[model samples]
Every structure is written in structure tokens, then in C-alpha cells.
Target: QFCVNYKNGGISYRSARDGFGFELDWTEFYTTTRKPSAGEVGALPVSGGVINGNLGIGTPNILGGSSIVLGDNDTGLKQNGDGLLDIYANGVQVFRFQNDTLESKKSINVTGRLTPTDYGNFDSRYVQDIRLGSLQYGQVWNGPGFSDTSGYVITGIINGNSDELIDGAHRRPIQKLIGNQWYNVVSI
Candidate 1:
């Protein structure tokens, strides 16, 4: 049986087979898969703006805590275009993933920290690039497992006195640091 119920300010289908009809919204139309639960996907946001750019997709039902994450299990993070794919927080690009093999980019770029007065720009000094199969890193560039980070260009503050700088070959070492007492990072 076909049915139409004028409720919830706007009109919606109800009862017997609200006849599995189509819904018109804005410039698009959607067909119902089944009767929606009272609070299926939660209420729509009270307010928001239209998006006109790229975005990242994360694992379903997962909200980032201290750190935001993108991509998902059994998935491929792909962007097909002639532009850089970037992840930004607060209008600043914290990470950039790219497939450009040109001499300009060299490899992917990751921005961990920015200089105090250098917000909203890629300082390069504080950024880290993944650099897959880079020619400069030589054998370690996408080696059997992983190779030295020295080959790929990166910048970091190395404690000249306390902390040891293992491969100082490729890093643009900034020796301006306080007395040692530090944390460690594990990379693959």
C-alpha cells in the first residue's frame, strides 16, 4: 500500500510500505533502502559549511584522539590528480602525501612541527618526507626492508653533547639544543 505522512516539518514516508519511494533533496534525489531508525545516524549537525576541496577518509566509527589518522585496513590511499594531497590541521599542512617522482618534490613530505613564527607554511627544516625508493638514499631507498634515513634529506635538532646522531649524512642537523634528556622514535 502507498502512504505519505506529513511529519517532522518536512514530509516523509510512513506505514505500510511507504511504497519504497524516492526522496528529493536539493539538486539530488535519493531512494530509500529501508525504514530509517529513529536515531540511526544521529541528528544532522546544527550548522556547517560547504566543502570545496580534498578530504581524508578514516576507519569507520573511529574518531581521532590526540592524533588524527587517515586511511583504513585493506585499503589504498589513492589520489588521482595533478596536485599535492595534504592533511591539514587548523589551516596548516601537517602532512603531505604525493606520488610525484619529479626532481622538485623528490618524495613525500611530512610536517611534524613548524617554527614558532612559521605557521601556515612548510618550513622544510621541520618537515619529514617518507621518500619511497629515492635515488639519493641509494641501497636503503625502498630496500628489502628499510634503509638509513640519512640518504633522504630531513632536518632535526641533534644534541651535540648528549644525544648521538647516528647517520648525520643526509640530515640538516641543527645543533642548537638544550642539555640532553630525550625521547626515542621507532620507524620502519
Candidate 2:
């Protein structure tokens, strides 16, 4: 049986079978004596409400398999059967979130600093080399056509090209420094 009761200045409706009912206190509604304007009759406020459960805008929650879906039917965020959160755009999977990992179909651009806590490896097949804008101090580079085995190093300064030295121990001619001059040491 359906019953309507007016008690304590409130109106309520109850179902006798399940004892489920709703009560509308008069003070909450009747306290505002002024009636709404023609435009405000069916209009809801833009803010000030708490939704405890899932909310769907243009599409239903069940149809999209997402807890919340925006106006577009193809775009939404859902947890897949694998327990991973997936983002969809235009009915295509764009991103997937796994354990500490985020996989994306498109490239990601970061405006701020992206610091990695751990070391990672890049595939040489996909990434040929890394280009940097500038290098810091104390860094060295090998010029083009430089070979490790055939490369030679200048030990000290030499006065001039005519000034050559003889190794006292080996009794052989070698490039040596006289005072503070520089010289080019060519590999033999």
C-alpha cells in the first residue's frame, strides 16, 4: 500500500510493503515564499552539489563501460578488464595506465623538468643518438676521423719546429718541450 503522511510540518510518502519512503520537510521548501521566475522554473544551479556516485553526461555509464563519461560518446576514461585505466579519444585507445607505467600512442611533450628516479635504456634501433644543446665544463670530445689506436698526444711545450730533442736513455730523436712553447706532434 502507498501511504502519504503529513507530520511535524513535513510531507512523506511510504510504501507499506518495503517501508521505503521519502520525506520533504516543509521548512526546506516552504521557507522560500517567493516563486521562481519563468526562466528559473526548470533550471538547475551551475554549482554546489555533491555527487557520491558515478555521473554520466551525454551517455550512460553502463553503455560506455566508464565510471564517468563526458558529452562525447567516444571519449571517456575507463578501467579495463585487466584492471588498468585506459583513456579513449574518438573511440580509440590513446593511453593506458599500468603499475607505475603510462603507455601512450602519441608523443608526450613536457614543459617542466622530467627527472627519472632510476636508470633506463633506449633501443638503439629506434634511437640513433641523443643531441644536446650544449655541453658543460670539463667535458671532452673526439674530432671526426679520430682513431684510438693511431692517435698521438703532445707531452709538453716545444720552442720551434727546428728544435728537436734526443732521448738521453734511448738515444733516439723525439718531440720534447724546451721552455713554454707549443708544437704539433705528428704520429709516425
Predicted candidate 1, C-alpha RMSD: 24.6
lDDT of each: 0.36, 0.49
Candidate 1 residue-wise lDDT, 48-127, digit = tens = 53334333356441222222335542232223345645444433344456674322323445688633653435443353
RMSD of 2: 13.9
Q: In model 1, how large is the Cα lDDT of residue 15?
A: 34
Which prediction has the highest TM-score against the true structure?
2
For model 1, the stretches where C-alpha displacement exceeds 4 angstroms are: 1-83, 101-188
Clashes of 2: 0
Best by lDDT: 2
Worst 10 residues of 2 by lDDT: 134-143
